[model samples]
Structures are given as C-alpha cells and as structure tokens.
Target chain A: EAGVTQSPRYAVLQEGQAVSFWCDPISGHDTLYWYQQPRDQGPQLLVYFRDEAVIDNSQLPSDRFSAVRPKGTNSTLKIQSAKQGDTATYLCASSPGLGYSQNTLYFGAGTRLSVL
Target chain B: AQSVTQPDARVTVSEGASLQLRCKYSSSVTPYLFWYVQYPRQGLQLLLKYYSGDPVVQGVNGFEAEFSKSNSSFHLRKASVHWSDSAVYFCAVRNSGGSNAKLTFGKGTKLSVKS
Candidate 1:
C-alpha cells in the first residue's frame, strides 16, 4: 500500500516570498490533515479536510496561510508571505475516517521549510 | 479543550534496561489516548491507542501503554530497551468522549539508549 506523499521535501524562501506545499494522501482515505512542527517541538494542526470540504482551519493563519483540497485526493498549502516564524516542517497526514478512536493517522516525510 | 503533557523532555537508559515514559492529560472527560514514535528525519507513526474497556493496550515494537483514569495518565513502557528504540515519543489525546476533536500532542520525550 502506498503511503501519503508530500513534496518538495525541502524549501527555502526569503521573507515575503510565497511557497506552496503539496500532499497526496493514501488511496481511499477520507480525512487529510496538515500540521506544522517547529524545531524540537511537536506538530501543531494547521488545517484539515474531509473529502474536499474543510473540516477545520481554525489554527491556520488567515493572513498568509491557505489550503485547498478541491479533488479530495490531493491538497495544497500555500503561504502568501513567508516569515521566519513560518519556517517549520510542514507535515501531511491521512486517515480512513474521523471516528475518533479508530482513526490512525499516517504521515508523510514532511517538507522542511526555511524562511530567511 | 484537550491537552497532553510529556513530563520528561529526555530519558537515557542502557540497552538492557527497562523504560517508561510518562504522559498526563487534561480534558473535561476521559479522552481517547495514543502514543507515537518519530525516527530521525521521519514522520510520526502510531504506536498504540486506547479508547475504553481495557486500561492497557499493546503496540508495535514491543511497546505498551497503561491508561489510568484516576491519575489522568497514560504511560508507555518497554520491557527492555534497544538502540533502535531511540527516538522522539509523543503522547496524544483526542476529545473522544463525544466530539470530533483532533488529536492533540505533547512536546514529546526524546529517548536515548546507550549500548
């Protein structure tokens, strides 16, 4: 079975530059999530989707961060104006459903971003 | 709101020694719990999960966690350590009592094994 896939694995941007991270979730997965992990810290949820509709995006920075999963199979997270604080590993995970206890999130290698 | 706490930021032990990683949680009610491990330059992988019923759940790589409702804790334990087991371990909780809340993670504990 193929796992969740993300690209480009690494990205570097100067302040105010824009960047987009892409994710391809596992086949048949109904839930997709995006998280941000700072250095030596745990991942923080940025946004999530269930079959092309956003389930929650409360943590996403409205001013610069935007995510879309129009086809329900792939997703894209965009940062309009990158800042140093946005320099974190962008992680994408997928699960079968949102059944609370039954959901087991499978993650991708993540895109390590560095905003100068 | 649901939250997780990993009391130990780091732990060191010899290869043959036993290991235990502590986790505490706070929520309006007992939530679904989980443990995950992350290898160097890799993403998080599920170790185990607990919702209800038995207080103990077994996970991959000989890992197991015991949930204690009274203490509001779920601690990960291994019979003996291996060098390959050195990684960052994260404890998480979901608002599984009723809501569709997402999994919340702790700061994580970095385990180091000495051969």
Candidate 2:
C-alpha cells in the first residue's frame, strides 16, 4: 500500500512570493491535516479537513495561508505572501477516521520551504 | 488544551545498551498518547500508541513505552539499542473528548547511537 504523497520536496522563494504545496493522502482516509514544522521544533497544526469539510483552522495564519480539499481526497495549502518566518517544512498527514483508535496519522516526507 | 513535553533535546547511547526517553503531558482528561520516529529527510512514523488499558505498550522495532498516570509521564524504552535506531522521536497527545481534537506534539528528542 502506498503512503501519503507530496510533491516538490523542496522549495526556495524570496520574501513576498507566493507558493503552494499539494498532498495526496492514502486511499480511504477521511481525515487530512496540514502541519508546519520549524527547524528544531515539532509539527504545528495549520488546518485540517474531513471529507471536504474543514474541521479546524483556528491556528492557520488567515492573512497569508489558505488550504482546501475540494474533492475530499487531495489537498492544497497555499501561502499568499511568504515571509521569512514561513521558512519551515510543510507536512501533510491523513488518518482513517476521527475515532480514538483510528486517529493514527500517516505523513508525507514534507515540502521544505525556504523564504529568503 | 493539550500539550506534550520532551525534557531531553538530545541523548547519546552506546549500541547494545538500554535506552529510555521521557515524555510528559498536560490535559484536563486522559488523552491518547503516541510516539513517532522521524529519520533524516523522512516523515514521522508511528512507534507506538496508548489509548487505554495496560500502562505498558509495545511498538515496532523492539520499542516499548510505559504510561504512568500518577507521574503524568509516558517514557519510551528499549532493552537494547541499535545504530539504526538513531532518529528524532516525538511524543504526541490528542484529547479523547470532542469531535475535532487535534494532536499536540513535543519538540522532539534526538537520539544518537554510538557504535
């Protein structure tokens, strides 16, 4: 079984530039999440969706970041105006369900973004 | 709100020696706990998880963790360490209640195995 897939394993951009990261989750998974991991830090939740409906996005930087899962299988996270603080690895994860036992998330290798 | 703490930022252990990495969590209620390992340039992989029942849980790659409610700690352990076991380990927690509880992660502990 193939795991979660993400594209553009690395990205380098200048300040104020815009970029988008895509994710394809495992088949049959209903929960998809986007996380930002700064160097030497743990993954922080940016947004999440369950079957095309956003479940939570309170932590997302609304002004510059946006995410969508239109068909409920694939997702895209975008940064409108990147900043130096946006330099971090963007990780995509998915789970089978929302229940306790099915909450284990499988992650992608992540897209390492660098804003100069 | 839930949070996870990994006291040790780095740990060095000789091969074939026992190992232990500590984790602590803060939550209003008992939360689902997890341990994940991330290799260089790789995504995080599940090592083990504890939801309920036994305080000790076994995971992949000969890894195990003990959950102590009184101590509010979940520490990963291995009877014998291998060089391949070197990686950054993250401890996570998820609230049991509510429908949209997200997982909270620790800063992570980097383990180095000396041969």
Candidate 3:
C-alpha cells in the first residue's frame, strides 16, 4: 500500500531557469493531479489527467507550465523560465476513480521550489 | 464554480479542551465536502468526508464534522484535543456531478494545542 511518490523534495533556482517535478501515483489509481501551493495558502490545481489523457488544464500557464502522463502511471510537471512568483510547493495527488464518493485524493510530500 | 472558506486563520486551545473549526462553501448545487489535515513537512491527509445522508461524519483520530445544508457549512470538531492534533486543517469541496471534478480548498486553519 505505497502512497504517492514525488522526486526532488526541494529545489532552488534563479529567475529564468527551468525545472521539472515528477510524480509516481499509487498503483491502480486512474486520476492524477498537479497542484501549486503558495506560501501559507491552499493548493491550486494546475492540471490533471485520467489514464494518460488530460482532463483539465485551464489553470495551467500555457506559456511556461506543461504536464504529461505518457504511460498513465507516472507524471511530470515542468516550468519553463521560472520567476519569483513560481516559488511555491508543487504537490502531486492521485485518486482511485472519478466517482463522487470514491475520489478521495492522496498527496505526496511535495517538491518545495524556490526561485530567486 | 465552487469554493471553500475557512474563517479562522489560526486557533489555540488547551489540551483536553473541546475544539471546533469553521468552514463554509459556495456552490450552485450540493457538493461533496471533505476535511484534511497537514502536518509539518507532510502532505495532506483525509480526516473525513461527507457526500450525503447523515449530516455528521466521523473521521480518523477522533475527529468529526457536521454538515449544515441550511448554512452551507461543514465544521470540524473534537470532543477533546491533544497536542498531537496540532496541524493545519483544510476544508475542500467538489461538484457532485462532473467528469473531471477538482477539489476546491480553503486557505486552511492552523490549530495550536497548548499543554
């Protein structure tokens, strides 16, 4: 019963640099989501996928942010030309299904990103 | 659109004291509600959830939440608090009917237990 796993527990970069965060969801989970949590704030959804197909990404910054779940088991969220505003914790979560009662999300420790 | 609100930014309570955290939601229809707790340097963990039926639902660690449709609120409560219960509590909501339902979270309430 392994929980969701994320890589690079922390990251620091200068402005204009690029970085990517990876996530490995729990086995058999079909829904994967990426969220951004600013300091002292709740998580904001960035993008989500269900079985390799993106379900929603309206909040994603099209110019710099991108995400993909090629094989449906793992996902990667990238930020190009990072800025100071991008300094936040990048969280990854997954759920078993889309059912109203069963979609409880399980989250990872999150990658704390700092852009100077 | 759906949203959640946590009125209290922080709360302090003595050990063994009763606790209550306030939450309110705005949505066109009845939404699925949830409460999650986040410990230091840890991810969010589900405390409890309410989709329908009973207005009160029990969660892990002796936590419970009551849903009030008239007030559009779901408040977390505990009969007795413990020092270990100190953490940031977040209230969330998601539309009951949707294909790609996303949980909208509140700013969160930070609870401190004083021994």
Q: Give the top-scoring candidate (DockQ).
A: 2
- Per-residue CA lDDT of candidate 1, range A1-116, in tens? 99999999999999999999999999999889999999899999999998999989999999999999999999999999899999899999998864652467899999999999
For residue A106, model 3's alpha carbon misses the true position, in angstroms, by: 0.5
TM-score of chain B of 3: 0.98
User: Judged by DockQ relative to the true structure, which candidate is superior, 2 or 3?
Assistant: 2
Return whichever of 1 and 3 wins on DockQ: 3
Q: Write the per-residue lDDT of candidate 1 for residues B1-115, one digit (tens) a residue.
A: 8899998999999998999999999987768898999998899999999988999999998999999999999999999999999999999988764436477899999999999
Off by over 4 Å in 2: none
Full candidate order by DockQ, most accurate first:
2, 3, 1
Query: Which residue pairs clash within candidate 3?
Result: none
Q: Report the alpha-carbon TM-score of model 2 versus the true structure.
A: 0.98
In candidate 3, stretches whose alpha carbon ends up further than 4 angstroms from where it belongs are A98-101
lDDT tens digits, residues B1-115, model 2?
A: 8999999999999999999999999988888999999999999999999999999999999999999989989999999999999999999999876786599999999999999
**DockQ-based CAPRI category assigned to the predicted complex of candidate 2:** high
Q: Which consecutive 10 residues in model 2 chain A have the weakest lDDT in total?
A: A94-103
